[model samples]
Target chain A: MTPLAAPKALDSFFLEARCKILDLAAILDRINRGQGAGAVDNDPRLDKIRKALEVLHDQSGGRAERIQQIFSLDYDPGWDKPKPRY
Target chain B: MYYIDPHIHMISRVTDDYHRMAYAGCVAITEPAFWAGFDRGSVDGFRDYFRHLTEVEPKRAAQFNIRHYSWLCINAKEAENVELSRGVIQMIPEFLNKPNVLGIGEIGLNKNTKNEATVFQEHVDLAMKYHELILIHTPHLEDKYKGTRMIIDMLKQDRRLKPERVLIDHVEEHTVRHALDNGFWCAMTLYPTTKCTPQRAVDIIEMVGTDCIMANSAGDWGKSDPLAVPEMIQEMKRRGHADSVIRKVVYDNPLAFFRQCARWQEWPAETEVEKAKRKPAKAHA
Candidate 1:
């Protein structure tokens, strides 16, 4: 099978997305600093954002691979395995 | 240009979101019971949530001229607690007759566990007893395909469930056919991330053609867009899809599905100009 060429537009798209992420992180940092420790504590939204950022930071793949993984609907056969209870 | 968001978590959204949605040409929305970002400790929490869905959110949406409908269920995430799920399921009938209450929904699998499946079947049994419409939520990411398959199998096993009355939501390319081919309705959720984008949703429509298909924002407390259906409309227009085609996917299809509700009232089909000429009056609660 022929490998798909990367879309040229996505280069700028990802760059712009990264800038927005950084800008959001900066704003959140500023808010945290201004609010001090008490205000940040037990805020579920902040915790969720922090966890999402950690997941992004922990991703090992390149941007193209990550984008494909995020958007594609390809089924994983391994998902048939039994999952643990929440 | 008016549309119906067949599924959204409006309780998680603010009043301004409803105002913006009304301005964006949304006439109606149906919110399925979903995970409240965290699990509740007792059945009383779900009871209050149900009251909020049936009582409060409807009034809130009405302030902006948007009709609000809701489904009752112990969401799949919380279904893991089988005891609490059963209690919530038994209590669901108390609110099922509420004017704005739609049916049982957002009720499918989360982890594809045995307990989740058990609670799912019990919920199905209750819906069968009430003859209510069913709305399903397939799992996310890697679990979606298998989870959807499992849900389909379960639905098929229930002889009483008419496929057309059930809607399998969050269907993507690989999972869309499973829902449609079985004669059930399906929806694509347009989220900012981790779901169908507007372009992709339009592409799916082009591939599958618009039969029992629809799209929603699925906007919630998370990073999602409430204007996603409108975004899809713009994309479809840009791709030269006829206005009728866009309207079917966005407006007509959802109404068609929602019309099956026992309490659904038919609203008059009036043009924007016609609506404007009418005297302003308060909508019935």
Candidate 2:
């Protein structure tokens, strides 16, 4: 099976998403660290997943934000309309 | 002149509601994806639903001069089917940046099972990934207590959540404090049949100080009303609560929350032209 790479917009999204996931993993580590190491059901392999999400979030923040500026701009809230004169 | 009902189901409501809302001065709204008492089977079902929520409904409300917005998610009751539900959920981000799609949910527990847990976590991940607000739809009936517990526990795991940005819906007398105590904004649905009532909600606000509490009708196939906010406001007034308190819970709270979304940034206040357009519409209605 071929690994699917993201489109420009989706890549930006995945990048930011990966960052948050890693941040979450860090919190889990902090808790487990304080709980004296045996508190969590640990799998050392999960560290790879955590690191990847962190890297993606950081790298995507720059590129995806630029692409989002070009493609994902939105304007639908009723705020821009002129206020009614009663 | 500004009050936002952050969770109101207008799909089951009427054009009269649009008029009523504008007249009562509804500034904005957020409709969560909720059960309509029947199962919606397939991704196409949710696709059509999300489109209606984002497109058709907002257009209808525009004619009445009310700003409409909503959340995109697989309803929890339907989330019972994990694979089928994820297929629907996976299609959500396609519409996430739509004029109305504020967040990934109205997603939380129903039967408090693992699939509910699985989908809830995925919904949280999507929300965190997108940096969008999460409007969690907690379960109803006796299952609500256990379900809210699961919702909080899972949320505690997700570090991306700010706690304040997570809105837990369908809170009752007992679980209301738990949701607030945990630092999450709590939304109580003022349904006629099964959820919290308006007077009781006021009592809650009185005790809880209306800090992070808000109300919605969440009117669906079951009996409900879109006027639940105004009714609650009137009740709070009748109870002699200060006008500032009334504005906080019924008005300012939701306004502040909806404006946090990047999509609602473009909404403008109604103008003379919009009023001119509204006059003809009211006569027709």
Candidate 3:
């Protein structure tokens, strides 16, 4: 019989959290770069990118399932909104 | 290479304190006014104490090449008598703007009484009014945690007070979270018999990290040490804390704190200090 996988150590969750936070940071950078550089969004590909990012940044509680879930996890919807003119 | 005691009571201390602190490589000290040996009876008591703290202790520390900083406030224990303490609080402005007066501090609840709570709120108001940093003195024994929370609530009422500038002193195991979660700087007092031991302080530093954690020798009427700050630093060093971490906790943090004092260096000695007045006030009682 195949041996079961080794049990996780206490730091596994913390390490996972650190990786997730870093991943979020990288995605945010990419989106900001796209906006600042005035990247064209005519392709259907850009729609998929924006949708994915919207979900990931706004998550509430239970763990996300797939990379899509990471994108779909809405934390602060207004976080990426443009500033209002006074 | 050097350490700072962020919350010592040098006015209630002795001459040997200067010698011992110098031996510890204590380059600077911050003395927050607390009970002041006995309950100060009048506003003049505060005036005299402030003069001594600003004018006297600096002279004392200079002999040992130690810089002294003073925090003027009505202590928590004294808060039990709100009427008398209010009289004292009114006089804080006289010296708060004086030289080396780092902040309005060492003020919080004692005995968890209403009188203590009221005085605590009063201190918060005064600190917020002046945009001064606060130095909180938590109650000893059972009231430590409760008093810390009470002080935090009062602080929250005023959005003007920033957590970075406020220092909560004399925290034990149970009192740390309230200080940290509130975003205030955390200070541990190493009193040999009662508050915290040097070894326990090491354990705390290991758990909390050194960003805003500082250790002090809060030696008052209790059995304590003038070298407790250095002893705690030594313990952390022997336990393998980095030199940078030691500097942040002991030197950088206190120096930055004193620098933020509203009028810390403005009030030089009003009284012409007689020659060679660098003797610690062991005999002030």
Candidate 4:
């Protein structure tokens, strides 16, 4: 089966994507306006979000998976080992 | 546009949710046993939950012309209490004979802890002993990749469990290929937030094709939507996918998966005219 034609796919979703980008921008603006904003300037999660935004601009495809990985946990080799209960 | 939510938690949803889902063309659904927000104190708590899954929920769904089937297990959250989990696993066989019972599932890891793994293997033993199918719950955001890998390794370690007889739920963009590459059936949980959205699910379908895969709402005692599968159908249509391609993913793939169970019964039988109406599309990807 042929993949969704890139031009048609973009045309179908442009408005929805525009709305989501607006939502993300509004969310970040709200976060910056909050009282605790300065304290979170160096937060790693925010850094990751920034990195994910950078990924969105890349011309190479697969941005969805790359962005998902940006927010996902790094694989821990010893995750199955016994650990202290919190 | 008829679809099946291969994984959903109707026990946590209201009757109106079922009404809405039925109107959205949900013909059937399978509710996997999952955490009840908090850990229960004992095995009897789980027994009552199972009774609800196997008994009450099916009747509730039937009111809306929806066929409800369920998987049985002590979910990972409660499985941390190994002693209680064992008792629950031992008692699961009591409901195995119930007409709606499908297999053992939503049964894998949460934090990828050793105790969770221990109980998961025990559930596998119970499932294997009964010749039942298995369904797994991979962990959430931070732990998901590792947790899914751990669950796959554990299942692979047990030679008696065939990959086809098991399904790994909650697969995302990064982990979906791994689950499918290993030969196990997989599902994407479409949520309004946190998990895959309708658009992302459609993207995954485009990337992976439609074989041996399915999607679900996983609607439960949280922020979720019971009509997520239909939302995916709409997204597929908007992307210009053929109806046959959309139907195969939402309807045919789930039916093919569930039909593997020993007690599996045909549901909502389609008439010859209905079959003729849905022209077969090319079945690639």
**Fnat for the candidates in order:** 0.04, 0.00, 0.00, 0.44
Per-residue alpha-carbon lDDT of candidate 4 for residues B167-221, written as tens digits (9 for 90 to 100): 8999999999999999999999998777899989888988999999999999999
Cα lDDT of model 4 by residue, A7-71, tens digit:
87688778989999999999999999999999999999999989999998999988988887887
lDDT of 1 by residue, B160-254 (tens): 88999999999987788889999999999998767899977876787788999999999998999999999999988766677778889998899
Top candidate, metric lDDT:
4
Query: C-alpha displacement of B212 in model 2, angstroms?
Result: 1.3
Worst 10 residues of 3 chain A by lDDT: A77-86
lDDT of 3 by residue, B142-212 (tens): 45555666667667656677888888888766667668988888888899756788877776776667767
Off by over 4 Å in 1: A1-86, B271-285
How does model 1 fare in lDDT? 0.84
Clashes of 2: 14
| Best candidate (score: TM-score) | 4
Off by over 4 Å in 3: A1-86, B264-285
Better of 2 and 3 by lDDT: 2
Interface CA RMSD, all predictions: 10.1, 25.3, 18.8, 6.6
**Native-referenced TM-scores of chain A, all candidate models:** 0.46, 0.32, 0.32, 0.80
* Candidate 1, chain A: TM-score against the reference: 0.46
Chain B TM-score, structure 3: 0.88
Candidate 3: tens digits of C-alpha lDDT, residues A1-86? 11112343233245756886798689767866775445554554566566655656766622222222322223221222211111
**Pairs with steric clashes in candidate 4:** B209-B285, B210-B285
Provide the global lDDT of candidate 4 against the true structure.
Answer: 0.88
TM-score of each: 0.76, 0.70, 0.69, 0.93
Give the lowest summed-lDDT range of ten residues in model 4 chain B.
Answer: B274-283
